[model samples]
Structures are given as structure tokens and as C-alpha cells.
Target: MIKSCAVLGEQFVFRSLKEIMAKANEARSGDELARIAASSMKERMAAKQVLANLMLKEIREYPVLSPEQDDVSALIEEQVHEEIFKVIQNWTVADLREYVLEDQHEGADLLYIAKGLTSEMIAAVTKIMSNLDLIQAASKIEVKTTCQTTIGMKGVLASRAQPNHPSDNLAGMRASLYEALSYGIGDAVIGINPVIDTTENIYALLNETKSIIDEFQIPTQNCVLAHVTTQMRAIEKGASADLIFQSLAGTQAGNESFGISLSMLKEATALINEKGTAVGPHRWYFETGQGSELSAEAHYDIDQVTLEARCYGLARQFNPFLVNTVVGFIGPEYLYDSKQVTRAGLEDHFMGKMHGLPMGVDVCYTNHMNVDQNDMDNLSMLLGTAGVNFVIGVPMADDCMLNYQSLSYHDIATVRRILNQGPISIFKQWLEEYGIMENNRFTSKAGDPSIFMNGVLGGMK
Candidate 1:
């Protein structure tokens, strides 16, 4: 394999594709912490140059994590279309980049070629692309999936109303959800991060949210983010959940650390399809972030970007209704600052879309990170402009249960207005009927949670 290259007359040698991939990534704290990052800017440039010249076949043959050792890798190998792979086998990573960005190439073209590409091949081009390159390329792709409703339409932007509570107080959650629905959010799903993870608690949350949806005739789904097994148990107990939620990682070991396996995911999918309340072939809602494998000490010396892309690789097999990257939730240890968080956000979105997964982003940050609401705003707007399928919305941008700051209901509304986009068509019609939104814009009644308490929402009072 080609493992060496020259830049500015200085020769650089990489030990393997893993090392090249790690060094070629834009600087991140996790890579530095893992001691796998390039020592200097010039060395990083050298790695990128070497990676750009390698043929797609060479990269695919030298899988960073072997199929024999990891089921995730094996599944990715099984999913790649061999015939399509043969057509582009000889292309260089640089050639692939140019092809994706070519003026005449459209979303369908990228989605077609994506069938042939491995996650490593996708990560290779990402390492050499600029931030805007990620945005522009991702903007062209539209990945749509259905649960209770379809998201990811070209002119539509959906949102998940995350009305999280620290103590699992039903009233507090319902209050937050009322505010969310008033602003035309929750079109993606009315999801919550419960302070408790027990099956009983999750069932209660799901039932409560479902009751609200049923009473108001809201056209969206509901989910309670919990351990997959716990969610499955709750579903078995007759919770009317439209989607099942779980956090995912790139490697088998990392997934084990999360207490999940491919088999477990398959079983959950089967259970949901048979017992769940959604009218769909798609039902899983997955979350991934960079550095998760590293955090679990399961990265196998691969870069976070590549590992993150592998998460998408595994997710593609599931045909998920929503796959989100909680891009900044892991803290400054991985992203470091607004700059790194913003870059990782765009990279994750582009990589997920490239994999043909219906992708969304929880453009968020924890308190310890060197990021602020303004940074979240920047990323949210960028992701929205890139045609993100949906985003997470919490009350006032603060989540009591998770203790992180995500985009607010107001923020999602503002982004939709600025981008000239609306929610899923069915949810939009419901909002119009409730006088919350009209002609694709918020009405005077929007943002007034009391609109629900005053018996306007189908006489709930």
C-alpha cells in the first residue's frame, strides 16, 4: 500500500491506513489526547496528500478494522454493492472528492455512488475537504424516511421536541411540550431524555406523551430515550411508542460498552415493528457522536471522524427514521471549542447523508465545553442550510435532565423562518388548524403555551 508521500520536499511516512486517517483529520482534542494526531501542521498536510492519492480499492482492501474482528465492519462489508464498487475501484480519494463536488452531480448521483463506498472511503475524502465543502455537498443530498410521517424533504425542516425533566415530573414535561407544540416543533418526534432509565419510567413517559398526541390529534411520533433493552421491555408492556431510541458507536467493543449488539438492535427492531404504534417500515432513532469509541477505549487507533462514519455504516443497515449526531455533547475533550465542534458537526452531517441515512443533528454543548449558545446557533443555522432532516429542541435551549444546552424551540422556529422552510406537511396542517402557524409562518398564537390550557387544543382542559 502507498503509505508515504512528500510535501514541500519533506517526506512523510505513515504506518497504516489507521495512522494516516488519524493524522489527516483536522486537529481535535481527542486525537491529541489519544496521541494519534499529527505532530505538526505540515505532517497533517502530508498525511492528507498521501490519503488523497490512494485508490479506493486499496483503501477498501485495507480495512481499518478487519471484518474478522468486528461485526460492524463485517456488516459494512456485506452492504457495499460489489458491482458499484468495481466501477469506481480505481478512483483516488481526490478523484472521489472532485466527483462529488462536480457541478452536474446531484443528490441521487451521490446516493448511487454511496452504495459502492465504504465508510473509510467516505472519511478519507472528508479529511481533505474544507468546511464549506462539507456543507455544499451535504446540502445537495435529501434523505427521507417514514415513521408516523416522512421527514427530510428538500424544502422541509423537522424538529424533535425534547421536553426533558430532571425528576421525571409529568406536569413539567407536558408544560415544556406544550411550549414546543405551540411553536410548531416536534414534527420529527416528541422525544425526551428521561432522568430515569427504568422500563416503568420510560413506559410512563411514552404513555403520557402519547396521550397528549392522541388528545390533540398531533401528527408526529413519541419516544423516550433510554437503554435499548429498557425501551424494548416498555414496548412489550404496551407503550404506544412510534420510535425506539438508542445511542450508537462505531466498533463492536464500543457498542458493547453502550450495552448494545447488532443482534440486540435487530431484536428491538423486530419487537417494535410487531408491537409498536407507527405505520412504517422504519422505526429506529439513533444518536452518534465523535470520540465515543475513543471514550470507550475501542477506537482501534482510528480517527473519530472515521469511527463516526462507521456508526452511520451500521445505521444504514437499519433504515432508521432518524439518525442524529450529538456533535458537541461529549465535551471539550473531543471537540475543544466552537471551531472544532462546528467542523465535526458539518463532517458528521455530510458523512451521514453520504451513507444515505436520514440524518439530523443535535447541535449541542455541555457546560464544561468552551462553547456557548452562539456556537450552537452557528451550527444549527449551518446544519439547517445544509438541509438537515431535523434537529433537537429543548425549552429555552436548556435541558434539565441532560444538563446540556441544545437549540431551543425558539431557535428551531427562527431557523425555519430564516431558511424559508416548514415542518413535515401533516404537522404543518395540524399547526395551522390550531392557529399556531399559517402560510408557513408562526401566528400570533404561537409561543403561548397557555393556548393549550385555555381549552383551545381540542378541549384538553
Candidate 2:
């Protein structure tokens, strides 16, 4: 139809749907489907094949493209609602499971509950699909993985803070956190990797972090990226720790590197629960990447992606506040190059999200690898659309201390803009209030500092 916001308007949407259906049927392969769609729309992704095929399958019986029907809007809604209701009423869980298996994909039915299925439909939908199978299919859509993650958390588009200081010093920590806020990221949790392990440092770090929140007057929380035992000690010393962050591997030796065991993780969680109400409710942050298993020599010959997913399983047991796959942050030894690195990012993201862990991806890369902004750009878009919880928004996509390039604040902004999503909902309003954002959108001198300076040049002395 017409190029306007009308694309989102119900009537226009229906027209576009008809257009897509007609075009899709004329296409043959997935490539053809993409080409045909893009001839009118912009570039359609390969995934369009799955959707196109579904559309074609449904529309084949209606050889007539009649626009004569009165009240197309009601017709569209009724047809969609009826189809959904039929799926629930006509198929058993076993049948749905069989359909998924036979087709070998499309677990989107799992999101039926979220997509507007009524209570009556749900009551009849005892078996839309097996919970376990649905989770698996959600992960496998784009990534080769098995597991699930907590997709939505805190009633917001899940996000987080990652600040790594070379010295883990207070000043540097404050700077990183401030910079993160400048980009409008304060909703999730602020976590810092403390290079120094002393209780004094951890305790002081925690308090100063609390001060940062008070200074900014924001409803945010802080955490220290230290060993669980070290964090526990700091907590015992009265530090206001909000999250217990850990890195895990599937194998015993791999996990030992981080001094994390299932029992130990459980104990730490229980200890936090018993201590006090300083930290509200609960929090657990876990980091996993494809190369870590092989790096630890704990692969036991299993593939990195599979082992990485197993790490997701481990984190899920703790009810993770955040489970992120630092996609390419590990380096070249294990992931090889950007192609493999990019693929692993999607895999880890899918796996974490499958297990119901609040999932995000540290869309990043190491200098030693054959990668650049383009690699991360592509991966970030994939993650955004796949709805992987969140991403790390470090300065310049560079972690001076960690020695890797990560998603820049601009990367986050770009993805959020494309997805038409705002940062952690409440914080979005706060950002606008503080003028960091305008109208729920990030405001900035986006490209170069020089460009921003260009406007003010006339006033300069």
C-alpha cells in the first residue's frame, strides 16, 4: 500500500498482508521469496521464506483476491482470532507437538498466550505445544542451540550495565557508570568487575556505587563482579550488593576456574536471601560465551555452542537476573573469526533465552579477531529482532580494560530505534525527564563530536 505510518494502521496492515501473500506465492525458493518481497518492500531477510510459505499455504485455497468484502478490518481480526481459537480448540498438545516436529520448526505458537489468546482459548489450549518443545523451537529459529531464557523481566525490554576498569578503581567505575547513563542505560543493574579482590575494595566499591545512584537520584542498583565467595564476604561486611555475577561452564574443571558449583551457587543465593532485604527480591548475573569451554579445556570434545548452552542451564537453576553471551568478547582462539563469532552470538542468545533466563548479548569483538563494526552491526540487528533480552553499551564499543570492542551506546540506540523500543520502560521516562532523551528517544550528537561542534562554531571566540 502507501508508504506512511499507515503500514502500522490496521487497514493498511491488512492491505500489505494481501500484497505480501500475492508476491510470496509467485516466488519459489527462499531466495525468490526474499527477492520478490524486496522488489516492493526493502530487503526481506531469508527468514521470510518460513513466513511466506505459511502465508502461501493458508492463501492457496482462496484463489480469489477479492477486495469487495465489507469491513475488512473486522474480517481480518475475526479470521486471525478464529484461526488462533481453532488451533487451541482443534489440536491437542500432542497434535501441536507433532505438527512442530513434522514441520521441524515454528514454535511461535508458544507466544500465543502473549499474542492475545483469551482465557477461554487458554483453557482449551491445554496442549498448544509442550513447554519443553516450545522452548527448544524458540531457540533454534536462528541459532543452532537447545535451551531457553527468561525473555521479559521487570516488565521491560531487559537491559544491563557492564563497566570494567583496569584498576577497578572508584573514579573509573564512576566514569563508566556516568557514561552509560549519558546514553540512557540505568534500568537493569550496574555491575563492575573488581580487579582487586580485597573485601575493603569490594565494600568500598559497593558503597560508592550506591552513592552514584543517590547522586544521580535514580532508582537503580549496583553489583561487584567478584568471586561469589568474595561478594559474600563483602555482603557480610554490610555492602549493598544487588547482584551476584558469575561465569560458568558445563564441565567440572571449567566451572572450577570461576570457583562456582551448583551447590555453591545455591548456597550463595540462599545466603543473600537470609541476610537482609537490602537487595530487593533477587538477582543473579551470568556470563557465557562459545569459546570459554574450549578455552578451559573442559569441552570434553563437545562443541562450544552446546557447552555454552549447558552453561545457560546451569545459570537458570539460580533464577538468573541476567544471562548474557558475550558473543565475540573471548577472542580468536576459539571462535576463529567474525563469521563464526557472529553465529555463536546468535546461538548463545537463543540458548539463554530458551531456558527462561533474562537474556542479553554482549555484542562484541576482540581486536585480534578478523572483525569490525559491520560484524557487530549485523549481529546486533539479529539479536534485536530475535528479542534477545539486551546488550552491553560501552563507550566506542571499546572496553579499554577488558581489551575488547563491545556494543557502543550508539549501537544500542540504533537497535532500539530500529525495533521501535525504548530502554527499560521506566528509565525511558526518566531519561526524557532529565533531557538525556527527548520524546522517548535518545538525543545526542550521534556521529562525530566535530559535527556537534559545527553548530556552535559561530559562537566560539
Candidate 3:
């Protein structure tokens, strides 16, 4: 019975090969024949080489799996899937062609064999491919890994700290906070100031901070190093109530004396001019204290100049690059109307007024309120519209447990449902009809036989 089965298999193989050869011959062109022969030879050689190499490597790596060992053959058969994966890695058409043609052995196959490797093996191959600049690749990998790992979490805050002054002895803290209802971890480190601050203590703090960062090496991509003195000076000097508002126009007496001083404004402007350019790509938030006497309209007008000055200072310093500036309304009343402020309004008021600013510059009018989905969506849309290159915002933490009402997955499903019901739903229905969304999430373990069919054959239209 075994002999008869072997004979039948050989006959089937011969018939298939003959059919392929006959089809190639019927093409009736020298080029077609050459192409057919090359393809056929390449496929056969690749398969044979892959099979031989896998067997040899397996024997060397796992000597105990030798056929001589009891049940070893059965174990090997059981590991056929892994063996197939291993074989495919070094089974290149070029390697096969060279071997079949009796050419000198080249190590090309070994260099490119990575696709079927484990994650650790893949990392090793990537390290090799990066040509020893592994840190840069590692940094990129770390960022991607961290992002994926921490997806769907909330209230995760990250910031980079810099020295208060270049010459200051104390280090600055660059910190990130990931919070959950039950637990929280604050990743904080001190780092050296790349730029000098006005005070020597700030500078010292920066150096100390750098040492801390070097020691801890927290893996994060989003960071900021700011010079607060410059931002402070800019707000002080840029706009004064006496110049803009008539109510405090006199030799500002009593509580009205709360208006900005010229000397302070000058210092602020100089600080902004000096440091705004020096500190690169940071969300600089300026906190100010204005007396309660000022109306919302009056306060906004004055604050707008402060915002512009910081933006202009950075733009002037960078000369063609945009820097992100955020003005923080610190007091309770300052943020009282923030919920009413739309992203569109802020963009129109601030970003639109600034000419020749780098496209990435953003003015976040943040108050005490924690950022919500509406905030994120609006910001995302604005960033999309502006063609900004980078954005700094808090990413959700992984451990954040959410109530059903607050979950985004439900929102996605609802959007899908709405699409299903409306005339515009045709596109969504078409996607389902054509199985794009289903195919994307389809898994073989779930017993979706169509997944195997769609993969092996072209998927259904």
C-alpha cells in the first residue's frame, strides 16, 4: 500500500511539472521560455535549499531532537510549523539559483534571513541593520513600544525640565506622571540645561538634572526644556494697561496700580527675545497675576499681546521655525470662561494674527480643567488643518479604568451604526459588504475559514 501511494504521488508531481512546462512551451517566444525556466528553476532550488538548511540547522541547534532519539521524529513532525517558518527565512530565490547553478557559496541568504525570527532575534537583526547606531533605533522603538503599551489610558502627563538659570547649581526636573484610581508613578529626573537661564542657581539645577536623566534614562519622546524667566519678562514688558486701557491711565493709584511697569515689560521683552529663541520646540506656558478689577475683555486684550510677544520672540529667534507657546490663565476667574472658548476662536484670535510663524506653533489656552475628548478631537482637527509637524499633549495611561459612558470604543461603534442608518452609511455598508473592516480584525484562531481562503486566494471583492 505504501509503495502504491509513493508511486501515485510521484505521478502527480510529474504531471504537474509536465503541465507547467507544456504551458511555457506554448507561449512560443524565446523570452517567455527563458522567463518560465528561470522561475521554475528558482522555485525548485529555493524549496530544496530551504528544506536542507532547516534540517541541518535544527539538528545542530537541537542535537537531542535527532531521529536516533526515541520519539524525536514525532516531536520534529509536531514542530513542523516552526520548521517551515525557519526554512522560509533563508530560502531566497537568488540563493537557490546560485546553489543550483553550482556557483561559489555566498552568505547573502544569512544576511537577509530575519522575517521568521522571534522578537528578540528581530531586535538583534535590527541592531545589526542600524550599523551600530543602535541607540537611535532603540529610541524610536522605545517610543513606539511605549505608545502602544500605554494606549487608552488617561491623565498621563509628561514634561521636560530645564535649569532656572544656566549657571545655577540646582538641577531641573523633567517629569511625567501616569495616574490611575489606585496607583500612580511619577517618572522624574534632573537634566542639564542646553541653554543658560538668567540665574546661576537655575544653571546648576540643569547640570544636576542632566545627571539624573543620564542615571535613570526614562524612555519618552515628548519633553520640554523651558526658560521661565524669559517668558515672565515678556509678559511684564509687552503690554501695559496704561498704554491700552484709559481707566488706569493716570499715575495709577490704589488697587489700579496693578498695571504692568515699563521696566518690568522691558526686562520681560529682553528675556523673551533672548530665551524664546534659545529654547527649542517647547510648550511654554506663561502664568500671570492680574488684579480682579480687569474685565474679561480687558484681560484678554492685554493677554493677547503677551501671547503675541512670546510667539514673535520665538519666531524672531528661530527665524523660520515655529515654537509652541501656551498662555496659562492661572486664577480661578481667568479660567471661568474657558469652557466657552472654542479651539476655532483661539486659532482665529492668536495663530491667524501671527505671520511667518512656523506652522507648528500652537497657543494652548489651558485653564485648570483636565483635557477631555472634545478638547483632544478639536486640537487634533486643528493640528491636522495647520499642517503642524509635531504636537505635545498628554497621552492616555493604560491602567485608567473608564466608565462605559466615557469609553471611546462605544463612540466608534455608534459612529458605525449611524453610518449604517444614513444615506452616507452606504460607504460604511460597502466596507462591510466588501469585508474590509471584518478582514482587518479577522483571526484564524476564531475559526474564520474565510480568513485562510482570503489569504491564500485573493480576498472576495
Candidate 4:
């Protein structure tokens, strides 16, 4: 079993990853590289990450090697890794950031990706920086986030209700919205992912969401997680898609796989502006994760975290209202387990915040990994203290539709209670009316069946 920091004792099963790295460093020739790479792919060992570790360690410790670099250099670049080697070979942190910022005439592409092809590069660069550096970077970027409860202000965190339903089921969605509001979440936004159909289905979901927001007079907006184009179509037909949701990557291939590109993002931005809503000038909600580029084969050999930052830069171009990194949702193939997940979660949060984005953490894990509740709880508290914009709110962090566990409403409440943070003012008022919350502390069972809960539950039958 690989031993990672977050998961220890009898529950851990991956063994000591440090030992594997020690073994992996022994590959000194092209033949060994080929052998290890092949073995790792064929399931002979889970130590494939050792290749990345070695490469990142070399880059972090040494300057650009001349043509007479060590044999491991050549071995590292053999075939499969050649793409990544070329991108990161001689690059430093500043160099990578410059590459991301250069204008089109200066060789910058429509998409400026500085991260996510490799995990090690980000790990390496971040390793060298202190917490003060990260804090300053975040402060320097300076993006403004606005929600109804804290209008005319910046630096607010909002909870979003991510409900996925088969088509537009009013009863089902009503319950989901009620669940979120009952817990004082979703002051930022309440959005849903339609299973298949985009236009009509999304239209229905948005309409229901709009109704909920209106009935409560809540200071929140609604969103449908459809493709930008599909959402554009819905808006053109008069559906209320107050927020645009999309998953972004650093590479063109990754964006294309998600049916989004830089040009498309621009068009969507313009389109949303044309079809204005109460949500105001800032209206893009983007979800980014590490390993998405590798998963989509679009990373072109870059580090995932840097790629994520580049993705943030792309979204920043349009002045996005929110961007969240589903840090551990991608599973163990990339993050390995909770230790890596914990590290990556903090890194992504730092990068996004550093780049002036309203960042939220989906401090979550998949069932297949070695992660446990302790890991999620720890990450939640850590991020909450860091002042993240929001976290995911599902029942027990378990999205039955998405088949992954994430930040539960209870988790959000626990963190909020501990930090003495309450939801946005209006949503907090609603919670107070329902007896669900009093003085920013979750009332638990003390919340009697108030008229608010009765009205919300009245339609549940």
C-alpha cells in the first residue's frame, strides 16, 4: 500500500510512495525508462508517477542542462514523455508565467496555459515558495466578486446547489433547492446539470430556479451547466441562465473535448452580455481540475496546476464571477490519494486566488480512492480559514447522480460555524426564519417546523 500523508494506519493501502520514488530514481538508461514506462502502463506497478517526480525534481534543483545532460534526461524524454519534456525542459516559474501572458503577436495562443500537463512542476515551483508569497500573489491579482447579500462589496464566499436531474423535474429540483436553502447555502448561486438534453431541459431547470429565487426573494441567481452555445440558445429563447458554467483546460484539445475554446468563451461572454440578467456584469462560473488536460490528451506536456492557473487567466479575460477547482474529483490516477489531494487542493486554491479569481474548493474524493471523511473535513476547515469563496453542498457530499462525494451541506455548516462565518445576509435570514440557524450557528434539531420549512416541504409529497 502506498502511504500518503492524509491516509495513515491500517486504512491506507498504497504502501510507501517514498520507497517507490527511491526505486524509480534507479532507472539510468533509455532501456530502463522504456521498461518502467511499459511496466507502469501494463499494471506491473503504480509507480508511474516516479517518472514525473524525477523530472520535476531535476528541473527544480538544476538549471537548464546543456546538450551533454545526464542519460536520465534522454530516458525521461523517450516517446511518451517527449511532449512534456519539451514544454518544461528548460523553463522556470517566471518563464512559464511569461509564456502564459505573452500576447498573440508575441506567440501567445488564444488559450494561455501555464499548468496541468505535469503535477511535479507545480509541486516543485510551489515547494520553493512560502505562504507569504502565495498570499501576496492572491492579493495582487485583485478580482472582485459580488453577490446580493454583500452587494457593492468584494471578498464574499457563496454556496452553490449543484443538482443534476433527469430532464426538468420540478418536485425533485424543489426538494434540492429547499435542502440547500434550509442549510443556508446557495446565496452565491443555485445551478444544476441537466442529464442529457440542453436547451429545453436547461430552460426548465432555470425557470424552476428562478421561481425559487423569486418566491424567497433570495439574493441569488440561477445557472444551468450546459455548454455555452446551448446556454446561449436557451437565453435567446428567453430562458433565465443567469450564470454560464463550463469546465476549462489549458490545451486546445481539452477545451475542444469540452466543446469550448478561447473564441467560444469570448463569444459566450459577449452573448451573455447581450442577454443581460439581474446577475450583473460578472457572470461566468467555471470548474477547473488538475489532470483534465492529461485526461483529454490536451496538456501538451505541461503541469496541471499551472495549466489550471492558465485556465484562470483565460477566465479572468472575461471577468468571471466564480471558478472552482474540483481538486480531488478526478480520482487517484492523477492525485493518487488524499496526501496528493490535500496538497493539490491548497495549491489550486492558492493559484486561483493568486490570479484574482473567486475560488471555491470542492474538497471531495471518489469512492475508489484511499480518501476518508477525515481528509475532506480537514481540507474543508483549512480552505474555509483561507477564505475560499464557497464549497459544494450536496447531501453528505454524495452526489448520487455524479457518483462522487464532495463537500456536504453539513460540512459547509460545520466550517462556517467554527469560523464564525455565516452565509450571505439574505440567505442567513431565511435560515433564521426556518429555525435552522441562529446567530450564525447551525441550530441542528432546535429548528422546529417553522412556516418556512412547512412551505418548502408542503410540495414534497
* Model 3 clashes, total count: 31
lDDT of 4 by residue, 1-461 (tens): 22222212212122333233322221212213223212332221233333233443254343221214322122222312345455666655444444433343121131123222233343334433444443333323334465333321233446877765554577776776676776777877787867765687777777888887878776787888877788888888898667777887755567788887667787888877777475466878898887787777665444455456556555555667778888888787777677777767776776675445677778888898879889999877777656677788876678867778888776776777777776777676766665666676766633222434466532331
lDDT score at residue 92, model 1, on the 0-100 scale? 98
lDDT of 2 by residue, 41-93 (tens): 32222112322223222332231222243121122223234555444443432
Candidate 3 — which residues are off by over 4 angstroms?
Answer: 1-201, 209-322, 325-339, 344-353, 359-371, 394-461
Local distance difference test values of all predictions, in order: 0.93, 0.55, 0.26, 0.59
The clash count of every prediction, one per candidate, is 0, 14, 31, 21
> Higher TM-score: candidate 2 or 3?
2
Tens-digit lDDT track of model 1 for 34-87: 999999999999999999999999999899999999999999899999999999
In candidate 1, what residue range of length 10 has the lowest lDDT sum? 452-461
Worst 10 residues of 2 by lDDT: 118-127
Q: Which one wins on TM-score? A: 1
lDDT by residue (tens digit), candidate 3, 344-430: 223322231122222222223332444445653454333333333222222121111111011121222222233231111222233
Q: Once model 4 is optimally superposed onto the true structure by TM-score, how far is the C-alpha of residue 219 displaced, in angstroms?
A: 1.0
Worst 10 residues of 4 by lDDT: 105-114
Q: How close is candidate 3 to the true structure, as a TM-score?
A: 0.28
Each model's TM-score, in the order given? 0.98, 0.65, 0.28, 0.70
Best by lDDT: 1
Candidate 2 segments whose C-alpha is farther than 4 A from its true place: 1-157, 276-280, 443-461
